[model samples]
Target: MEEAEAEEQQRFSHRQRLKAAVHYTVGCLCQEVALDKQVQFSKQTIAAISEVTFRQCENFAKDLEMFARHAKRSTVTTEDVKLLARRSNSLLKYITEKNEEIAQLNLERKAKKKRKPEDENRDFMELDADVVGSDS
Candidate 1:
């Protein structure tokens, strides 16, 4: 149907946009590194690096998808992400630490869930004040 074709076209367009954004970000990072090293990079070199980074990101996504599917889950979970990071010990450790931090934060949030509405509003006000203070 025409709708299906249109949806496919939209998906392809979104992908191209994502690729462009990633390419631009990779180029900027490469430029920064090259400057720090007092070296110049050619267009080809930047393009190559961007391509590799983009490919790696795509592979990581596919891997997470497969990991979730293998676990018989419709959504990717933290365990799936941890499995993906298993190739690098440091990454796994970092993720584990981050997960612990998130868990602690969740516990804190749940403990605060029974607080009065006024307390929650005050918390938001405090957060806003902090943001404003930091902007000065």
Candidate 2:
């Protein structure tokens, strides 16, 4: 029982570590400017916690480093972070627009279907009434 409990705990720890790594990596990639300058974490520190492949992380780090070098800026700012965070809302906006368009199309299709049946029925009823009057 004790061995089983220990194994469970170890598994839980590993999961937690992986979760932390993924969170940190995503945050770093998404907020490169804000973290690179304002945050005081070493590259090794970032690497230790990230689950991302070495190449991906390396590329991300390189881009930020290059930005910093080119801009002659010593610190990453909130503005830098802003660049990454800007993408957060556009995806939701796109989904909402698509949903609205689909709803409109569905409504138009239903209206058209209803009208076709009603128009045909009205014409058929008129023809039947004319035949009855003439026969009488």
Best by TM-score: 1
Model 2: worst 10 consecutive residues (lDDT sum): 77-86
Tens-digit lDDT track of model 1 for 1-136: 9999999999999989988998899888888988899898888888888888889999999999999998889899999999999989999999999999999999998877757677989899999999999999
Residue 69, model 1, lDDT: 91
Full-model lDDT for every candidate: 0.91, 0.70
In terms of lDDT, the best-performing candidate is 1
Candidate 2 regions exceeding 4 Å error are: 1-87, 133-136
TM-score of each: 0.78, 0.32
After superposition, candidate 1 runs with Cα above 4 Å error = 117-136
Question: How many clashing pairs per prediction, in order?
Answer: 0, 2
